[model samples]
Target chain A: MAYTISADGLRKRYGDVQAVDGVSFDVEEGEFFGILGPNGAGKTTALEIIEGLREADEGTVSVLGLPPWPRNSKLLPRIGVQLQASSFFERLTAREQLQTFASLYGVPARRADAMLEAVGLTAKAGERVEKLSGGQAQRLSIACALVHDPELVFLDEPTAALDPQARRNLWDVLREINTEGRTIVLTTHYMDEAESLCDRVAIMDAGRILRMGPPATLVRGLDSPARISVPSGVLPLDDARALPGAGEAADDGVSLVIETRDPSAVVAAMAARNALTGVQIHGATLEDVFLELTGREYRA
Target chain B: MSTWQSFRSLGRAMFLGFVRDKGALFFTILFPMMFLVIFGGVFGHQSTSKVEVVEIGAAPLIDQAVARDADLRKTLKVTRYETRAAALKKVEKGDADAAVEQRGGTLDVHYSAADQVKAGTAQGLLGSIVESANQAKSGVAPTYRLAAQQVEDDSLKAIQFFTPSLLGWALASAGVFGASQTLVSWRTKGILRRLRLSPAPIATVFAARVVVSVGVALVQLALFLAVAQLPFFGLKLQGSWWMAVPAVVAGVLAFLGIGMLIGAWAKSQETAQSVTQLVVLPMAFLGGSFFPLDASPGWMRTLSYIFPLRYLNEAMLNVMGRGLGPMSALPQIGVLLGVAVVASLLAMRLFRWDSA
Candidate 1:
């Protein structure tokens, strides 16, 4: 199978910080590949390296079988990129912005109208970019990126600052692009978004891929404990951790919650210890699996 | 896509961008026109008011004595102030030529440093008036002699005096280097980075910006010239259009290089603007935008020589004012070319791909 993106031992550093220290991955053609990580997990740094925006200090990266960098490469026009927080000329209309990008790619300007429509920004085609809502601007950005109908696309947090509805709308657009036999590589921190959008996901941390697989497979592999909630002040933190089958117990403002794989066993033991009264079981989510694998703390 | 095609596309975008930017139009074009109208209206064609001497006391004969001296009457419009103190106040304010007081047998003259030449002229006139009074009232004639010098040149015009500097400053004001700033900002916004991944070469984007900007700058130049040629001002273009055409093109390139250097060297738009001011402000002022300095000190003149605006101004002045040929402007042209080459090289060197 042909891979849309391939990298081996990619390494990049700025000053003393090893931003993308020796990362390697292959994204299959037409696959929606997602890079999921916490903030500063080197997701953006790694994406930038593959997109040809930054040079890798060591290792090789090939996008659609061509090196991306300052040197001339034929693969550039065949790829579309939606960068996080990218802006258009404030004075330019959405259609004009799209057309400009199309022209830069040496594509016909007629496609700009269609791209705008695809992104649901056709009604605001003549409106200046500065006047567009946050969602509208994002849609416009996406339209500009896709004006040339490229086969490979890179969207770095394409829906980062959008409202839920806008984000959903953008996701639908991305799906449509993917459905048309084009491959996509996106980086996002929203676990649900990554699960919903990506065919395969890579969980990154500290400039390295901690895990990579299909979302379902990755989630299933995690032996994360199901959470149990109890009334506030019901159990002390130490007593809960000491219980059999309990992994960790955390206190919510009004409730005590515990993580454990064998929820039933833990509940019975808690009942014997008089620690299960008023406790409730909740289903596991991607956040739980993420916290279990990456630790339940924020990293800058 | 070929490089030409990419540049063409970028050029179209830049032109559209410029057209849509109303604020830029207002500041670059309209604001400068307003300034020119206000300052030119106030100062242009106004004669110098150098000196004022108030003759006081026992001058009924002195009044008649002033009437006898045609040279004094022609040169000085002696106004009668309430007192010598009032005249002295006028001199202190740089409003008077001199104040003359005759108390007892002593004569006192008060004048300002600003009006030194006028003061001397006033003193000479006063002495002649006194002599004439002595001849008329006391029958004692005093001997004196005077010389006169005359010059005639029908070349000077108000527009020519203002245009060169105004053109340079206006072109430099919000243009030239502004393109680089815009590009850098686009990069910061991630738009340029996105563009970088596209088929278009980054060099094409730069070329397009220059093309559109140069075109707009030419339009502004034409507008300033048109405004200067209204019936009242009647600005004459004395030099061959050929002489000025190349210089204007050269001036654009030179300043564009300076602007590019600022844009490339500075990390942010704000820093670029500040740097642009550092180069533009002094060149506009000291290089002779607001006022021409024919009589300013040598050091000041020397400093002006180092500025591209100064050479541009001199070259333009020679062509527009003296009807000189292109060869007459070779030194200025050479300096402008040198500035352009050096600035372009520096800009290329300092140009950064990322905001960091």
Candidate 2:
């Protein structure tokens, strides 16, 4: 398969701090790839290096088979970038802002209106960007990026600081863009957003990637125990512990919980005892994998 | 993406932004036009007032001339003093505009320098009186005579000078302030990074900005000329006045370069604003925008040479105010273009895409 982006041993430093340390990754065509990390994890730095906004201290990056550094013009027309901070031309209306960007890429003016409609900002198209709410402004910025219809798109925390509804709405927009078979590389701190949207994710921290894989594959590799729980009083703590295949059991006020390698055996034992009322089975997720790998709570 | 398309789009957007900004409109166009109105009203149709002269020790020549010529009598209000020292002291104390005494064939005239206009009138009146007296004594027509005439139009008023000088001031402020503020704000706001990521060439982006700024400056020049030409102000455009167009373009480019240098160096809007003010205000005062440089002290006139606005004002005044030929503006244009190239190169060295 032809890779859309290939980065090798990327390293960047800012004074005393190593912003990106020996990071490497490859993205295939039409892939929705993500770099997931907390606020200080150097995800933005790594993304910037790949986007040609900054030079790396050490490493090589190729997008669409072309080097990005020193601003390769050929690659610019083929890729879209949405920065963490959304900035527009002064006092321009939403449509005008998109149209200006479109003109820069030699795209027709009609694409601006079409892109605005696609982003569901047609109603507010005539309003100045400053007047738009955060979500609307974010949408306008994304539309500007996509106005030229580049084959590859880079979004740096496009959904950060947004309300839940807005975030979900933006997720839909992003999914539709990806559905059009364009490769997308995203940097985000939201674990659920990464897990749901990215085909593969690189979990980073302290300027290093801890793991890189499909979310489900990474979670399954963890081999962590599942927790099965029922409403308190449904099963006595002692009986839960004595159940076959249950590694440990406890009653924590609201629920009687059992940790077991085989969730099916635990659930079967609970059902046999007529103690399956309100049973909830918790499986290993990407969050647990992050915790297990980092040996700390996932703050983001 | 063609460079022309990028230039057109960016230029159109910037021009729209400028026109839509009420504060910029007021400062760049209306403010200088207001100065023309105020200065024109004060000095446009001035009539010379009488000068007070102190006669020290028997100036028979002046006494006879004042008695004979009604014009001299109306212009000079003469008073007698006992001693030359007392008359000189009176002039020094500003109580009298001049002190005059006839010493043999030479008439001694001393005028206070505190008010140049009044002193000039007094000196001219007394000198003419002495010359006529010499002719009467000789009792023969003089062989040679000195002819004096103004190089500019006969109807030239203060409006002519104020229009071009004030217009130069407006263009300087607008170019510097506009370029610096735009650059710093764009850096701080991350718009510079956004533009960098676009397919448009960086050169194209700046070229568009330059084009827009020059276009706005031309509009300012036109508005200033139209307003000053109104019969109330009576500004007459003279020989090669059209040459002010090229002068304005060069001047704007020079100011824009300085502004960009400031913008590239300053990390914030406040810093850029204060620096532009520091550079512009002093330059305006020293550049003959507020007053004629000829009336300034020698040191100040020399100091004004360092400012690009001085060259701009001089060039425009040569063509528009003094009615000089187009060739008169060439040297100033060359200096302004040199400044533009040098400052722009330095600005390029300091330019940053992000405030960080």
Candidate 3:
């Protein structure tokens, strides 16, 4: 498949800190591509480089077959963006803000109303932006981003501050837009959001793409198919590891955890011994893949 | 919509934004007008008192002669005083100009030195008394002319002088603050970074904002002019409104251009605000908006000439208050245009769309 965004050996530095270091990735057209990492994992920085916002120190990037900088004015109308910290002139009504954004792309007047309605902000269009609730303002921001009707849209942590219902509403709007043959590239820290919305995700850390694949593919690649947990005092660690298909076991204070390629076999053995009372088994998930790839170190 | 259409849209947005901002309007219009009315009323009363002088004192013998002289009685509204000290006290406080004391043939005249208007009136009275004494000795009298000079009255009140300037300050401040603050906030918000990936040119965006700001300022000036003509102020345009209009507009752009430079270069909105305020407030005050420059210190007058506001006020005051034409205002216009060009060029050079 052809890529809509392509970058090679991208590097970016902020004074003494390497914000992005030797990163590379490709996003295919019409694909929901997610850049995922812990905060400060350089996910945002790498995405910015690919978006043509920052110049890579020693890398090349092409978005829609054009260099991002020496900013290509001719290419601007083809894309939409939702900034991490979105804001507008406080006194402008939601309708006015949308209209202004539409004008920036030379879009028709009616497009603004359409975009606002799409974002479910048409009812409050007359109210000033400052007066809107956080969720409403966020919806207005999204409306402004879509007013131009670009083929590609970039959203950064768009649903971070939203309530669950609002987040779901945004997801539906995004899905509708995606169905219209537009590509979406998003950055997020929420694994669940990344898993559900992205067709493929690039896990990043220290300015590097540690792993890249579909959520299911990444999880299946883990050495352990399932993990068993139990109270730490319930079983001896050596004995738990000796179970059929159990590769290792560790005491986790309240549970004795075991990794197994076949959790059914391990459960059958536990049941044969009548030792299933305190055990729980779960398939490997995106979080396990994330923790394995980026490590569990706390980032500032 | 094309690029130009986008610009028009942004201009509309800015205009609507300001229209809804009551605080901004208050400072731009009502606050300045209030200052004008209060300052003008207080100062106008003081000015009128100096123009209408009261001269006191007379020898009873000369008073009889002066009261009998039809020519003298018609021109001078002379009042009798109980004591010479009382008359001199009034002159000293600028309430009266001249006080004459007569003992035999020697006449002593006292006048206030603080007010130039009072001093000039006192001098005229003294000259008349000297001439009248000489005429009396020669057994002849002098005649007075009753014709007034045809100087058309375009006397500007304090409000009339300050309204245009307050509007200029508002426009310039909004332009500088809007662009500079918006840029910084957008950067902090990661909007600029996202925009870089798109095909839009940052330079084009900046240019559009400047264009919008200048356009809106012109409209705001028209509003101020209309408000000046209301029944309360009774302002009249002495010169062609044409000359004053463009001059005021150019002045606003010039200051806005300078503000653009500060906005484009400053790292943060806090820095931009301080820089713009530091540059704007002094110029607004010393440029003769709130007060006339005639009696201001010579150094201050020389310094005021350097600020775009001063030249703008000069051109505006010339046309609006002095009835001068564009040709007469070319010098100030030339300076402001030069300022606009220089500021624009510097702003462009200093502007950075990214975090660089």
Candidate 4:
């Protein structure tokens, strides 16, 4: 399959911190690829490196079959990017802001109004950017990114800080863009959002990918004991591990939630030990998988 | 897109954004006007103060005394009127600041209090001269008959001296603060980062700014000249006043470069504004915007030469206020150009698209 973005052995460092350590990934054409990670996972650093906004200390990246760094003059025009917390020129109307970007790309100014319409900001097109609501400004930002109609798009937290309805509305816009056969690569901490919109997701942590696969496949590959919930210190620390099917238990502040294969056998043993007062059994989730792998809870 | 096309599009968009910004609009149009009105009100004409003193029966006697006593000729301007009614009419018409009538060497001073400053000055000088002239009534033998003659000297209005410095400060604040804050704000807002991703050159945006600044300065120059000529200001156009055109352009170039350097070095808009204040406040004070520095301390006058604003203000004054031609203003122009070149180079070296 043809790939839209390909990177290998990407590395970047800031003084003593290794922001992105040897990250490698391939996003195929027309695929909705998502990079899911908790805070400080180096997702944004990697995305910036691929977008050519930043330089990788050691790596090679190709976008649309053209090198991005040292500036592929022709490559920038063919790609779109929406940065996290992206701001715009003050006092410019939403339509005018979009048009400004379009003009820089040498595209028609009319495309700005069209994209505003596409993002359902047509009514607010004439409003100043500073006057727009959070959701409206976010849509305007996306519209500016897509005003040029690039073949590939990159969005870093496209719906971050948006109200639920606004986020849902933006998701529909992203889906429509995908329906047009354009490839997309985005980063988010919301696993459900990734599960719903991404064809394939990469779970990243500490600058490395812990797992990469379809969300369903990744979840199905996990053994039984989908999810376990109990108060901390409910069972003797050593005793819980000695149970029939209990794996390492991780406490996520509120409760000690652990992933295990055989939930019934562990529950029986815990009940006999009188440690089942708050014990509960539920289906496994991406959060459970993350806790089992990374030894840290994922942000809800 | 071709570079030309990119420039046009970006320039047009920036122009639209600049004009639509209410705060910037207020600064561009009303800020200088306010400064002019307030400062002009505080200090009246400083160059040459004109006072019309109508002489009654004392006309020929004062004329003779003025001719003989050179000191009297310098201080008192006695315009002889045939009748006291005619002299009072001139004072009422404001063609004269005060009226004076003399009968048998006892002078009666007639002055309108409408313009208290001018009238007070007239009263002090004429009041003393008339008191001394009446000494002949005090049984003191007259040593000799005194005669007075009037001659117009180099007395230009305070408004004439004030106009240039006010314009300089206006241009400096608008060019420096306006450009620097916007530059820093653009970086903080991610506007520069987004523009960097495009194929267009960022120079187009800055070029538009320079163009707008020069245009605004030129408009202000015309409006100021027209307003200052009104009866309120009573400013006289002396020497090569038109030479201020070049001075204004040079001023914009130098100050715009300084502003760009500040913007490039500042990490945020607030920092940029603070830095601009640091430069603007000092430049205004040293450049004689608030007060005349000609009679200031020697060290202060020497320090003024280091600031580009000083050159801009002095160049404009040489042409419009001081009786000097364009040739005399050459040194100011040369200094401004030198500063512009240096500042532009520094700005280019320090400018950054991403926030530090």
Candidate 5:
């Protein structure tokens, strides 16, 4: 398979900090790839190097079979980039902002209106960009990136600081863009965002990828126990602990929690006892994998 | 994408932004216009008031002239003093415009040099009075006669000087403040980074910005000329006044370069604003925008040459006010362009795409 992006041992440093230390990754065509990390995990730095916005101290990056550094004009027209901070020309309306980008890319003016509609910003098209809500402006920026219909797009923390509802709305927009068979590379600190959107994710910390794999596969690899819980009054704490396949049990006043490798077995035992009321089963997720890999709570 | 398309699109967007900004509109166009109205009202069509002359001793010539010419009596308000020292002290203290005494075959006129305009007017009136007296005493038909003529139309008023000087001031401030503020804000706001990621060349983006700035400056020049030409202001455009166009372009380019330099170096909008003010305010004052450099002290006149606005003011004044030929603007244009080139080189060297 032809890879859309190939980066090898990319390294960058700023003063005393090693911003990107021996980072390496490859993205397949049409894949929704993500670089997940905390605020200072060097995701933005590495993305910038690949986007040709900054130079790496070492290693190489190739996008669309061309070097991104030195600002390859050929690659520029083939790829889109949405920076972490959404910036528009001063005092421009939402539609005008997209039109300006479209024009810069030599796209037709009509594409601006279409893109605005696609982003569900047609109603706010006449309003100045400054007047747009944070989510609306974020949507406008995505439309700007996709206005020219490039085959590949990069979004740097596109959903940071957004309300939950807006985040979900933007997720739909992003998924639609990816559904159109465009390769997407995103950098985000949100674990659920990476788990849901990315085909594969690289979890980074202190400027190095600690692990890289599919979210489900990574979670499965952790081999962590699942927790099954029921309302406190559903069963006594001692009775929950004695249940079949229940490795450990505790009552935290609200619920009786049982840690077990076989969650189904514990649920069956609870059902046999008519104690399955409000039962909730928690499986291992990417968050758990992050905690296992870093040996600390996930801060973001 | 073609550079032309990028330039056109970006230029249109920037122009829209500029026009929509009421603060920029007021500062760039109306602010200088206010100065023009104020200066023009005070100085335009100004005629010298009666001169207070102190007569020292034995000035029978002046008495006879005043008695003979009714205009002289009205023009010169003569006060007599017992001693020449007292008369000279009156002139020195500005209580009298001039002190005059008869010195065998010649008349001595002592005028304070503080007010060049008023002193020059008094000296001219007295010299003419002496000339008429000499002519009357000779009583012979003069073989030759001296006739005085104005180089420019008599309609030229003080508005002519204020228009060009104030226009130059306006253009300089607008170009510098506009460029610097735009650059710094764009950088801090991440707009520069956005443009860099676009397919449009960075050079094309800046070219578009420069085109819009120059276009706005031209509009400012046109508005200033039109307003000054109104009957109330009485500004008469000279034969080569069109030369101010090229001068204005050069001046804007120079100021833009300085602004870019500040923008590239400053890390924040506040810093850029303060620095631009530091550069522009001094340039306006030292550039003879508020007053004529001819009346300035020798040191100040020399200092004015260091400012680019001085060249712009001088160049526009040459063609628009003094009615000098277009060639007179060439040297100033050359200096402005040279400054533009040098400052641009430095700005390029200092240019940063991001505030970080």
Candidate 6:
């Protein structure tokens, strides 16, 4: 296992609050790793520690085979970061902003325009950053982070304040960035984005990673494998329990839900009787796994 | 990229950003001009009124002729005196505005040193009347002569003495307030934090800001000197005008260091604005930007020395207004350079990329 970033026993304290407490993880080369947590879960703090934006009270962290602490001069040029709610120079167009950042690494100006096109901001290259919509600005922010063409990129809630469509649009951009073989470590609380984008995730809460694995593996580890629902009017609640592989039957107003390990068979039976008008079989999700593992909701 | 190359790129970007900002541009170019128009219109030109003269002999003949004319009589009030000593006494005691004695065809004028401009005006008016009377008597070109004296230093005019200080005030506002607000906003907006994430040296970033401020201050000085050059003010650069260049640069950098300190201390925009106003207004007052601090209380004069604006103002006045050479301006320039060095070092020590 070749890892691009590895950390152990990281701890950071802000006044009396323990921001990143005894956390550790390793992200392999070219892997899209994610830290999934609600706000204030210390994910940002942990990510900042790795990015060298902050110091850990007690920890040993390495990035690209070198320590990231004390701000390694060699390490900095090899990584990119898009901080949460980032801001740019006032009235500076998106292209110029990227050029300025590129200059920091000695990258050519042409890369700035190219990076703009990469982020789907080609038409907006001349528009001032303040005029950009939230999604566009976020995309530009990511473009700035990647302008130097670093191998590892960190995005902290890249789609935090966007509409669902905009969020989806930004998700495609992130996936495209990863497709270019760059290792990306992003922090997000949205489970669907995590499941779709991240190769592996560390579900965090209260400064700790409770579970670390692929999304489906973690979800499948939940006690209930699937939940099947059909309208109660199709067949009264008591009769649905008699269906095969139905673990527990419950009526949830207008529908009867049956927990089942074999939803395919359950779904087929409902369809045979012309009772499949609204039959819905949902596999366990990361949210369910999070709730089952942490004994708390995924949001604050 | 090399550090210098990075610095140039960043500096160019910063300069563009500052100039393109309409509010910043307006304040940089227009705010100081406002003070100039207001103050210059009021104090640029001067004129004098009627004078009461004690004539020793009363035989200039033109005095009698002038007495016959309503306008001339209204302007010069001449009275006869028995003796020169008595007239001189009256003038000394401030009873008479001036005493005139015509001897060997050259009028010896004794004006009470109450006000130099008033005394000078009286002498010129009396001499002109004497010449007119003589010309009427001889049908020849009249002579211009009068012995004028004042026991005090009144060598400065209203316009020349205050304009340089006003220029310094403008630079201070543009450099100090401007830089402080910029640093605060960047920190509050996460711009500084984002820059920290990059490999760019912190000094390189701040160097760009410092360079831009110095450039703005220089432009401000040029604009003021041009305005000061108009015939209305009739200003002469008493010393090498080039001395003001170093003075303006050093002064702006010194105040920029102060601005950095303010930015370091102020955690938010409101706090920065309040602190900037508090520092700038009082410094302008005590540093003699508006009026001479010599008339201010003694302690205030002593306390004003603690602020860099005072040295900057005095330095500008020394070079451009006082027209003193670079060596003569050394004391003020030394203070400014010292401030630039020490304050900048302290500010660098205290400056932070984030409130956290």
lDDT of 4 by residue, A124-184 (tens): 9889888998888888888888988899998989888989999999899999999999999
Docking class of 2: medium
lDDT of 1 by residue, B1-356 (tens): 87787788778767777777777788778877776676556655554343355665444444565576665564666667766677777888867777766665456777778867777888887776666556666765656655654321344655667765677677766565566567567767766666677777777777777777778778877887788767555567774634765676677778888888777777777887677778888888888776786757778888888778887777776776556776877788788889989988998998766775
lDDT of 4 at B124: 81
**Which pairs clash in model 2?**
none
Residue B177, candidate 4: alpha-carbon lDDT: 77
Instruction: Write down the DockQ of candidate 2.
Output: 0.60
Cα lDDT computed for each candidate against the true fold:
0.77, 0.90, 0.72, 0.82, 0.91, 0.83
Task: Please give the lDDT score at residue B308 for candidate 4.
Answer: 94
Q: Candidate 3 chain B: minimum summed lDDT over ten consecutive residues — where?
A: B45-54
Per-residue CA lDDT of model 5 for A5-28, tens digit only, reads: 999999999999999999999999
lDDT of 1 by residue, A1-300 (tens): 657789999988888888888899999988999998888889999998888888899999888878876554588778888878766765788888887788888788899988988888889999988889888888788787788888888888888888999888888988998999999999998998988989999888879988889888887787666889999788887888888888888887798888899888889888987976787898666666677767886555
lDDT of 1: 0.77
Residue A20 shift from truth in candidate 2, angstroms? 2.0
**What is the TM-score of candidate 1?**
0.79
* lDDT of each residue in B1-356, candidate 4, tens digit only: 76776777666666677788778867765777787777676666434445667876465456666786886666667788788888899888888888877666566778887888889988887766665666744878777765754331245457777788888888888889767987888888888878777877767777777877788789888887877777777777875888899889999999998999999998977788888989999999987887788878999999998889999999998888886867877899889989988998998999887773
**Candidate No. with top TM-score:** 5
| Positional deviation of residue B225's Cα in model 4 after best superposition, in angstroms | 2.7
Q: At residue B105, give the lDDT of candidate 5.
A: 77
> What is candidate 5's CAPRI-style docking category based on DockQ?
medium
Superposition error at A69 for model 3 (Å) = 3.5
Candidate 6: tens digits of C-alpha lDDT, residues A1-300: 658999999999998999888998999999999999878889999998999888899989999988887877788899999988767887788988998888988888889989988989999999988899999999999999999999999999998979999999999999999999999999997888899999999988778888999998888787676887777787777768887777789996877888888888877777776778777878888878777766674353
Cα deviation at B204, candidate 4, in Å, is 1.7
Tens-digit lDDT track for model 3 on B53-145?
A: 333455554465466687555445556677767787777876666677776776666766687766786667556666666677887555763
Tens digits of lDDT, candidate 2, B319-355: 9988989999999999999999999999999999998
Docking class of 1: acceptable
| Native-interface RMSD of candidate 2 | 0.9
On a 0 to 1 TM-score scale, where does candidate 3 land against the true structure?
A: 0.83
